[model samples]
Target: MSTDKEDLVVDDDFPITEEDVEPRIEPAKTNLSKRRTIDNLLEERRLQRQLADFDYDL
Candidate 1:
């Protein structure tokens, strides 16, 4: 048995896409160590933004 191309798609120029590229993302972030890592990264980003804002205001 073989599959047909026309049965699969409406247009070649544009194709439908899914909301999630990763199958299971929430489970990966649920770990305690992973959450802590994310928190630290966010704090560093916030500190950098504050410094940049202060420099522009002067």
Candidate 2:
């Protein structure tokens, strides 16, 4: 379906501030590759658990 341009918002009710941004940390150059691989493996495991009907009750 075609949408009207008026449906989009142009105003920024609550503008983002500098404090809202988290401080960046510089990672060790040698550790960067290993860190990314580990992160990817962890994400894969989490997704597999979800697909297998695993649940973490509150």
Which one wins on lDDT?
A: 2
Per-residue accuracy of model 1 over 1-58 as CA lDDT, tens digit each: 5665565555657655785355565665478778899999999999999887785644
TM-score of 2: 0.42
Candidate 2 stretches greater than 4 Å from native: 1-27, 54-58
The per-candidate count of clashes, in order, stands at: 0, 0
How big is the positional error of residue 14 in model 1, measured in Å on the Cα after superposition?
Answer: 34
- Over 4 Å off in model 1, which ranges? 1-30, 55-58
> What overall lDDT goes with each candidate model?
0.76, 0.83
RMSD to truth, every model: 11.9, 14.7
| TM-score of model 1 (CA atoms) | 0.43
